[model samples]
Target: MFDKLTRTFSDVLRQVSGKSSISEKNIQDAVEEIKIALLEADVNLRVVRRFVNHTIEEARGEKVLRSVNPGQQFIKIVHDRMVNLLGSETEGLQLKGPDTLSPILFMGLQGSGKTTTCAKLALRLKKEGRKPLLVAADLVRPAAVKQLQLLGEQTGVPVFAVEGEKKPVKVVKQALSFAKKNSFNTMIVDTSGRMHLDDDLMKEIQEINSVLKPVEGLLVADAMTGQQAVEIAKEFNERVGITGVILSKFDSDTRGGAALSLKSVTKKPIKYVGVGEKIDELEQFHPDRMASRILGMGDVVSLVEKAQETIQEEEAEELQKKLQSSTFTLQDYLEQFTRIKKMGSLQSLVEMIPGMKGNIDEDALNSKEMKKEEAIILSMTLQERHNHRIIGPSRRKRIASGSGTSVFDVNRLLKKFDKMRLMMKKMTKNKKLQAQMLSQFNGNI
Candidate 1:
């Protein structure tokens, strides 16, 4: 989501690359641009200064001078430094005591997507083969418990909630008891939030922490808040000693400032980032891949993980068989749309591919365009979705009426789907060609 930062770094690197030999003056000019970019993105001024200084010092080191491409060498130095700033190595969630049960607490401000993230984490833990219990300790708001319950239902996880309970500490203690009784291996406490930081709120969370002895206290901060987010994280860490940070809304137009500065400022690693609103959008924070994305390089590992999580194995296998037989159909088209829907917003998905952020129209990605297309497809009959040969003028009119869309809209969808299907067939014929095109597509992103 650091589109501006990526563009700035790319331009700076290009300028450095044009030089046969690097000089202090040239490096300073590039660093100046980077500094401005970081400041404009609302990065902490002190952190920006330190980062720029480190980059300059590294550029002047022997490694850059003896390198084949001094510009690329400088880029590597900057990337490595950025990774160090964002926490060089990943730190996974810690679970204490027996493997049969452990407590993990999530705390953050209101509207930080804490409940949704709690469900996401439960789904993740479930996939990892851990039996996690969802505890709704957010009694400050009436809907909090209901929201967690709905999420639990959607994820097929049990929600431990005490109706009308006003005390968070008591709610959590009871929830932990429920977890122990049910044999749930882990307890996740989704705590309440306040409009702003306060003593009572902190005291409540602290009391819950004291009772639960949580192995991990996760601060789910919204990434779109910029440098202020880092300050909030620091406050929480100072008050309650957060085990790690979780940056929600990473798919939004968040500058990488908070992510890059938080670890350095708070001395805590960002364990995970919420890339999308979907349950599968949660991903382990990888410093190296994040640095690569900020430098206009794609993150293939994250992309592959997203693909694996979103695309059903059985469906992929069937699609591969169809590709081998050159028998792709409109049904496959609908399936592709379904898969993308499960993966969350297309724009967000593209932005995670390293350099694709700024160049995309984010509004379009978050809009109802995909849903409208799906509706049009849903209006079609089974034969129509599969064969696409039986839709005559009358049928088209009926389908449009059923979908509440115009006949022109239906025609446009059919045309687009046909084109995509044709392109898929062409790509399937040549694996190397397809790989090359996909690589280029990733690079541009």
Candidate 2:
């Protein structure tokens, strides 16, 4: 998401990494480039200054200056300092035991995606084996309660809301009793928000907070708002006392100003980030991995985690068996496409691979090309999928017509599939190549 920052850091690294040794002047030059990049990205001026100063102080130390690889040493210093600026480690929600009613109060300005985040968090907690109830306590906005209700339906989490309750505190109080009676371990209350922070808004939130005695008063801020998100978090932390922050629309936050500045300004950890509009697109924030991604070093840990979450172990083992036996078919190939799509956008996944950042065509990876491939594969008959070689010219034209593509497109896909199959067959027979591939895969994990 930090595309600009990543490109700048990559450029700076390229200038320094190839050197046999680096001088203080070289470090200052690279740091200055970074400072400008951060500023352009809308990062806080104070944060940029502090980050720049700390990086220079560390880079000028004898340890980096006299190191065998000064360039690499300097890069490590930057990565470490960036991680600290982003919060040194991941911080999770502090919850009581499942037997207790752990209320999580959500607060934010209108249009910050606070209601949707409540559902997302509830779904996540449900997946983690907690009985979560989504409380639609956002009474100020006309459709907020309905929105939360619809979201709860989509997520399969129950929503607790009085039919006509106007006071958020009363709604939350009733929700607590309902949750405890129903054995719900976690209650996520979507409190009211406003266009701007007003005393009435703060008072309503504070009253609800006092009633719920929430374990986590999370402020959901729009990452696209840049520095304004940090200011909003500070205000909420001061008035309503937020325990953590959740940055919504983070996937679209290409500049990454809010995420880079939030922790430094508010001292509140970003517990979760809404990566996409889908209910399942929320991700836990990892500072070290984010730092790596920002430096164009990739985030293999997050990539592997996405794989583990979306791909079933049995399915992976079955695919391995098919590959070893040279029995992989177009059906298996299509299934693999579906699995990868579930993991995330191809561009995002590619960014997680080391050295692959900014090296992909966004249109090609995310647009009609992939959809066309899937359509062509789906147009194939079961027998054609199992035995692609059996498709003659007539069948090719028929499949292309069914898929709304030209015969040339179908042929291209078949050729690509054939090449892939041949490679897999070769790898199956080559024990040494297979071992090397397995070793690399395991090492990434």
Q: Give TM-scores for every candidate, taking all chains together and pairing residue i with residue i.
A: 0.86, 0.96
Off by over 4 Å in 1: 17-20, 96-98, 163-167, 278-280, 312-314, 354-376, 389-419, 438-445
lDDT of 1 by residue, 1-445 (tens): 7878888877876678656678777778888998898888788888888999998888888787777778767777878888888889978998754456889999999988899999999999888889999998898865989999999999998999886677888888788778888888889999989989999989999998899998899999999888888999999999999989999999787677788789889999999999887776798888888887787776767777778977878878889778657567666766788777676667646756655666666776754777778888788888887778678899989989998899999898878877776777777777899889787765443
Best by lDDT: 2
Q: How many clashes does each candidate structure show, in the order listed?
A: 2, 0
State the C-alpha lDDT per candidate: 0.83, 0.89
Give the root-mean-square deviation of each candidate in angstroms. Answer: 3.3, 2.0
Residue 233 miss distance in model 1 (angstroms) = 2.2
Task: Show pairs that collide, candidate 2.
Answer: none
lDDT tens digits, residue span 19-107, model 2: 88888999989999999999998999999999999999999999888999898888889889999999998999999998998999999
